[model samples]
Each structure stands twice: as structure tokens, then as C-alpha cells.
Target: MFRGTGFGTYYYDVRQVEACDTSFVAQNLSPLECSSQNALSLNHVNSNYVVAMNHSQLKLDMSKYCGKRVIVTVNGEQSNLPLFIGDGCQRCAGGSASSDVWNAVAAPGLDFSYSVLEELSGGAACADGHIQIAWEIVDDTIYNFSDGVNFETAPAEASEERTTSSAALVMSTSLSAASFLHTPVNDDPVQNAVAVLARQGYGDATEASSNNALPTDGLLASLAEPR
Candidate 1:
């Protein structure tokens, strides 16, 4: 939903990647008042891109997925290579008016374009000729933009195996398959983690179905195979 504050004659233009521009004519679209909010959704992957006007706010929303490792590209150019949601935007800040919140500092006098993606589901479907706000969850953790001004902080801990690199670490713990199965996926470190977990099995017994056992067999087989 691309809307400006205190609008006069504002144009909301949208274009598919490498495609011609399509314009949406809104008479009075202001962020202050609601009436011309264009709702849209996007499922983005490599090589998928869209262009639209006034997408500065959109960039902030998408920055959550990136954390510090990724970049948000605009219109075939890297304007804000590593973008973060600024503190002041009401939509991004969860609708709180805090003095501590800082407004996004965009490059002056630049009209932004559209598009973002990464696991967005169940939004009010875009009607004919309306734009949708699409997004995916890079990490579900709440990002505090005001947690100091370093954009390089990586978002969310990587799946286990990021820490520690010693097979001896697992040897220190008693290797009870039952106890191992119950171990929470979160931990300091574990070698042969996935295979070990797969060996014992997964899922609550109550939730088991015929197909539930099939994938685990393949996983165990693969893990047991020589590298």
C-alpha cells in the first residue's frame, strides 16, 4: 500500500520486472488518511522483481528478512544495499508513537518502485488492478531497529551446527538414544546431529501416520551412507 502524507495529485505506478510501467491514478492518497491504500502480495525468488513508485516504506518492511546479511535492491540498482526498517515508521514500528523512533533517511528526491517476497501467506487478495503487499519470513524474531545503528548484525541464529566443531563434544554426554531424541534442537553443539536424531526417529507418537515414517527412513539411509 503506497500512500503519501498530505497528498495532492500523486501517482502510484507499478511495473513488472523488465516490463512496461502501469500507472494507478489515485486522486488523494495520503498516509495520514486511509482511502487509496493499494493492497498486494508477492512471491519472490531469484530473477523475480517489480518496480513501483514510492516504495521507500516497502523497503523497510522487507529489511526484516535481510537482518544484516542481505540487501534490498531497487529498480535494478542497489540504492540501500543493506536496508533496515527505521524506527519512526508507524507501520514498521508496530503503530507506536515514540520520540525515540527515528524516521527513515532515504536518498532525497528518489521515487521508489515495488516488490518483496519470502513466505507471505493469507493476505487479503488483491482485487482487479490493485497492488498487493507480499513478504516472506526470513526469521520470525522481532527486530529492534533502535538496538544501536549497526546494520551488520546478522538476524536470527543459524540452524544448529553453527557452533562448535568437535566430535569429542558429543562423547562427553551419555549417548542414550531415548534421551538424545528428547533433546531440544537448540543446544551448544552436537556432532552427527541430524543423523543421530534421525536414527532414533521424530514426531510425537500420537501424531504418527503411515507416511510419517517414510521420510525418516530416507534421511537415516542418506546419513548412514559414506560421504
Candidate 2:
């Protein structure tokens, strides 16, 4: 989602690869490696709001959104996020959000920092993990992150609808997977990392009857085959 305009729905999780995890670092899947300079950390202590999307499914060029700030609205709660490309996962859209951003928008009693993997995979239903969000790019002319200015409150005129081109609308939809597939995993290191994470119980036990859910069998098989 962008600004106030509605974009297509996508799944989200709060799982993050720790900076010190060697497996993630070797595969270049760590948050620090995947995100831009604007999003250096996902620790709860940092106030920088950021979200990552699977690089494979991201049809647009990374240069367009990286380092740019967007107001992400999830379940009617809003946070400012810097966009970045992340490791890929089947049927997982809007890949992950920082713990701080998750805490800000998540319902009461759901703490991402306490149990990252459980919270991500223990949702009541697959739809519970789905992120119905809307986002809008912050106008760089009005607010700049480098200036050390904080945009705690949205602009007064934020509610007013702004016109976007067909290209922008198309770009929004392209960020998500249009269909679920069981195709063989290719040579992408980011995807290989996803497979490894799955082996570590990422999405192994999630009950997903829906077609949109990630295929656990496919993820496991990726490791068995050579790229």
C-alpha cells in the first residue's frame, strides 16, 4: 500500500535474521545486508521504521523505493518505513517488518521481540498473517530524513486523495505474488536462505489450507537439489 490509496493485499511476518547470525551473513540474508543505509537495524531500540519485500517478486527496480520513506498503515495503525529488498519466500509478500514497526501496529499481547518465529507462524489462520496495508511515499521536499527532522504526526492534508498514474498503480500490484507455485527453487542465494530458515522452523508447521500459503515441501526440496 502507498499513501492513503489502497494497494493489493499481501502477507507479512515479523521474523528477522539477526545481524550476528553467520548463516544469514554468509548468504547475505541479514537485515543489514538486505536493506539500504536508511535501514541499518531492526532492533527494537531503533526508531527507524522499515519493511522488506522479496526481491524476486519485486518487479520494479530497487533503486525506485530504496532509501525512500513511506507511511505504512496496517490495521489502521501507521508507521513510517524505509523500503528495501529482502530474501525471497514463496507466497510471502511484504516479506518482513522491523520489530519496532510490528509492535507499533500489532494488536495487544502480540510481542514480536519476545518470540519472533512463534508469532509469525502461530497466527490463528493464514489470513491473520496477511497485511492489509496502505502506504504513501513521503514527500522529500517537505520532510528529509537526513535533516534529523521527525515526522511523528502525518501532514494535516494527508487525508486528501492524491492522483497517481496507471504505472504507479501497476507497480503496487507487481510487488506481490499473483499465484502460488510449486516450481523448483533456482540458484538465488536469497531463496536458498529462505529454505534454510524454513528448516529452522520458519514456516514448517504453519497450517495453511489456502492456495496462497507457502509450500513447505517445496522449500525443503530446494536444499536437496543443486542449483
Instruction: Give Cα-based local distance difference scores for all models.
Output: 0.29, 0.36
lDDT at 34 for candidate 1? 11
Tens-place lDDT per residue, model 2, 1-227, is 23332222222223433322212222232343223445434432132233333334333545443434555555666643333223222222332432223322321111122122123234422334333445555434222233323344334334333334555677666643222122325686546555454555556434344653564557545654877
Cα lDDT of model 1 by residue, 1-227, tens digit: 22222101112222333212433323112221110132222111011122222333444454432222223332333333332222122223222222233233321111122222221111211221122222222342222322322324333223234444344466556466557666666552232455345556554422335666544555545655776
In model 1, the Cα lDDT at residue 151 comes to: 24
Off by over 4 Å in 2: 1-48, 54-59, 75-77, 80-127, 139-227
Clashing pairs in 2: 1-135, 2-135, 2-136, 3-135, 3-136
TM-score of each: 0.18, 0.28
lDDT of 2 at 159: 33
How does model 2 score by TM-score? 0.28
* Residue 78 C-alpha lDDT in model 1: 33
RMSD of every candidate to native, in Å, equals: 20.7, 29.8
lDDT of 2: 0.36
